[model samples]
Target chain A: MEQGLSNALNVLIVGMATVFMILWLVVIIGNLIIRVTNKYWTDEDLKKSAPKSNHPSASKGAVAAIIAAVEIVTNGRGKVTKITKQ
Target chain B: MDIFSKLFEMTAFGIVTYKTVIMWAIAFLLLFLGIKKKYEPLLLVPIGFGVLLANFPGADMGIVAAENIELPDGHYKNLFEIAHDYGILNYLYYALIKTGFLPPIIFMGVGALTDFGPMLRNLKLAFFGAAAQIGIFSVLIVSMLLGFTINEAASLGIIGGADGPTAIYTTIILAPHLLGPIAIAAYSYMALVPVIIPLVANLLMTKKEFKINMKQMDKLYPPKHQIKNIKTVKIVFPIVLGTVVAIFVPSSVPLLGMLLFGNLVKEIGSSTSRLAEAANGPIMNTATIFLGLSVGATMTSEVFLSPKTLGIVVGGFIAFAISIAGGIVAVKVYNLFAKKKINPLVGATGLSAVPMASRVANEVALKHDSNNHILQYCMASNISGVIGSAVAAGVLISLIGG
Candidate 1:
């Protein structure tokens, strides 16, 4: 009984530790892959217009309402060639 | 030979033993559980029917190998005679089961149906799945103290994993003699998780803990920005994980490899739709029937009636209970440091009963608070439990079998 108890203890520790180890590695690697992929591959349209600046309400960042104004002045046909942050 | 004598000889009463009658009763109970109770009917109905067929006096449907056949060198004239003597079920047992083929195929099907997005999203929550394996080790100790051999105890211990394929695979490798009872016990307790997990959770945790709504936990810590283009990571994960596991514990490769391969087929998107459908449908269902029946057929009067079988059944239940507690305990520990508190009940879902365990967790949380939609969160641990059990089985096979 004592020997079995000791062996069982070994299994408990080792088994738990191994599971954690493998999964922890997976977690770390998974995060790394996601991080790397996202870093290199932000979408082109999202990059073209700053999400923070483009919202009509504009409570936070500097507004680029100039893009809408440009479209209106062009009779809804013109693309805003460029906008510089002031 | 009188006509009456021939009639008497053909009757079941003529060859029935007390043990045979007891086996029949057990078979009937399994049938009731499967058909009437609707408990794991896919497996239980077949197993129950197998038990019934095997118990019939003159059917010769039992999975016994041929007896008293001696082989002397290459010139084997009696090979056909030996083949004729073998039971029909024994052929299935040797072909699909004895070589350890069916369980891995079943895992492939399971993998095809699995979605790893949840586990990948919350990697920290996944460790609770590992913690749930504490039940397997605890039962291993008890079984050993009760005089089971180390291999036999290892087989008994894995029943706590709550993943039928893992339990079946481990038992077939370590202690094939105990496979029938272990498989039955594993599946039976899995069906009982709705009752068992809540009892353990209620005992260990307070009512407030059960009501910890993770969906509302964004108040504690702001949710992280969701990552984009996750498909690339999903495709790569199973292959990388499978490689690492196989490299570390080669014995686990067959089961884990097939599982990851199946997932790969599913996630690769549109290219392998036919293969994926076949793997998760017909292949899986066929394997389940053969596997269930062969496992049931192994439970002859002598084997299933033994005291050790009782110990295995009891030990399996304890292992399952302890596993639930272990997951809950791990979640409590995780809650201590994390900025956002998880519903500790999610921990109880960290056994590999898949959507069933996750559904039970969701149901329990909904009972406490209707708006607590933590199914996705609970699924993280549930899927992790599958991999965790496979790894634990591998460790046991390596440590003890070595």
Candidate 2:
């Protein structure tokens, strides 16, 4: 029983420490990977790879308001072209 | 009258004992839970049927140890002898489960299915997953005090990981005899995540804490680091993380390595999508069926009806409760120093039950304030819990499994 308890104690201390150490290493390395990759990797492929957005189009009221504001600011000189949601 | 007596001896009714009857009831209960309550029906149904098959009188369907097979030469049976004598269930149990093959394959499937986006977005929250593993070691000590051998206690303690594969894999290494009870405990508690998470959260957290809005905290203190190309990061993460973990705890490589490999294939897109699909679909499903049946076959009336099984049931529950509370407390401690307060529900989800734990935490958060959806944040810790528990299992196996 004494030997068993001692072994159990050893496992408790070492198991938790190792778990935390390895997982923390994962977190640190994971973050570093992100930073290094971002720094070196070009985003030229991003536009092509990016999925088409399925977001709903802006309402008529919102479009009218934007056009009205533009008309007011430019004193009827600005023309309304195509509008797309970012 | 003599012919009738001889015929009666050929039937199971002649040999059935109360133990067989009791095992039947237990099997029925598991089937009821799986079929009616829908508690992990995919696994429980097969396992329940396997249990019933093992307990059937005159069938000899239960898994038998090599040493247990009596021979005139007084030597253990080889695989051929066991296969020839004891049949298919025993053969599969020895070949698949005892060899420790299926759990990691299922983990590979789990990895292919996982999305590590939320965890990468909130890296600091991953620490809570490590903190939640306190339950495993703590239960190890307690089970020893309760008079279990160190190996048996380690197997029991792994049930706290709340991951069936991890528990079974560790048990196969540390104490194969305890595999049946440990697997059942792990899966049963996992199915009870909805009930268990709320129970632990309600006890440890305040209403104000429950209402802590994660989105509000994010708005107040915006994150600085952002992944410029998420696709590239996803593809690179499993490789880097797998290397680091394998270096530190080589024992974890078998399980974690396969997991990372599966994730890599999935992230690689069109080139490896077929591999990912095969892994997560057919390969994983096949492993699950064999794993479930073999594990259930180990639970014969003689193995499972022991007093030790009762201890496992009770100890498994305490381990689960402690793991949940450990996560919640870690979040509370983090809140004390940081400007951004996290809901304890996020911490409570630091178990390896996957989306279920995260969903439960999300519901608790929503109940307090309908707009407060912390599912993504909860997933940060939930996914980490999978890695954490697997690492913990590796540590235990390395330190004592020899």
Candidate 3:
């Protein structure tokens, strides 16, 4: 029983330390990956690669009106990507 | 009279005992919970049915321990002979589960189904997932003090992970005898995430803490950087993280490696969509069926009707409660120093129950203030809990099983 208790204590210390160490590394590396990717891969690049709508682009008046509505509704947090007729 | 005696001997009723009847009642309870309550039905139904089959008299359907199988020649029966004598369930239990093969395959499917976007967006919250794992190790010490062997204690402690595959995998390595009880405890508590999360949260958190609006906090203290190309980042993430984790804890590679591989296929889009679909669909479903049945088959009348099983049930519940409270406390501590406060519900969600724990936390937050939506933030910690638990399992396996 003494041996078992000691071993359990060892596991408790080693297990928690290892788990925290590994997961902390994951957080740091994850942040680094995000920063490096964002630095090299700009939003403009994403926009360029984005698939074009099969239908033609909406008229300037319709596009402006839709953008205005979205801006109001989302308080400038939303962006218009595609406009299609129902 | 002679013919009547012979016929009676042929019937199962002649051999059925009170133990067998008790096991059947237990099986029926599981089935009722699965079919009626709809609590993790996909797994519980098969497991319940398997338990019933295992306990049936005269069927010999229960999984037999290797040493228990002897032949007339005084030599142990080989795999073929064991299959011939026992049943297919025994064969599967030995081949798939004893070898620790199925759980990682199920994990691969889980990975394909996961989206790590929320976690990546809120990187700081991932620490709570690690904090929540305090329950697993804490339980290990308590179980040992309660007279369980170190191996058995490790198996019992993993229930705190709240991940069925991780628990089963650890049990298979450290203490195969405890697999049945450990698997049942893990899954049952996972299904009870809705009940358990709220219970723990209410005990640990205040109303104001629950009403902390994550959206307002985000606006006031915005993230320093934005993921401009999320697709590329998602694809690269699993690879980098997998490599780093494998280096630190090589024992985790089997489960974590396959998980990252599945996620990679899913994130790669059209090229590997077929692989992802196959992984999350047919492959995962088949593994769940076999896993549930084989695990349940291990729960024979002789094995499961022990005082130890009762300890596992109680210990597993305490593990869940402690893990939940750990997460909530971590968030509260973080709030003390940080200007941007996190709702304690986000911390309470640091369990590996996937969307269920996150959803429960979201509901609790919404109850306090309807507009305080924190599902995405909760997910950030919840997903990290999955990784944290898997890593913790690996550490236990390496330290004890090795």
Q: Which candidate is the best by DockQ?
A: 3
For candidate 3, the TM-score is 0.92
The reply for model 3, stretches above 4 Å from the true place, is: A50-86, B69-78
- lDDT per residue as tens, model 1, B1-402: 699898998887788999999999988998899999998999988888888877888877776632333346534324355347656577677678877999999999988999999988877778888888889988888888899988899999998999898999898888888888898899899888889988998899888988998867865675565667577778888988888888877877777889998899988855576688899999999999999888888888877899998898899999999999999998899889887888888899889899898898889888988998889999999998998898888899888877
Candidate closest to the true structure, highest lDDT: 3
Q: lDDT per residue, candidate 2, B1-402, as tens digits?
A: 999988899888888999999998988988899999999888888788888888998899898754566567986666787788898888888888987899899999999999988998998889889889989999999998898888888899988888999999999999888888788888899999999999999999999999999999999998878888777888999998998888889998878888889899988865677789899999999999998888888889999999999999999999999999999999999999999899989999888999999999999889999999999999999999999999988998998896
Share of true Cα-Cα contacts across chains kept by each model = 0.51, 0.69, 0.76
The interface RMSD for candidate 2 is: 9.5
For candidate 1, list the clashing residue pairs, or say none: none
lDDT for every model?
0.83, 0.88, 0.88
- What are the root-mean-square deviations of the candidates from the true structure over C-alphas? 8.4, 8.0, 5.6
Q: What is the C-alpha lDDT profile of model 3 across A8-78, one tens digit per residue?
A: 88888888888778878978988899888888986678657443443576555666577667765775567
Candidate 3 docking quality: incorrect, acceptable, medium or high = acceptable
Q: In model 2, what lDDT does residue B174 have?
A: 90
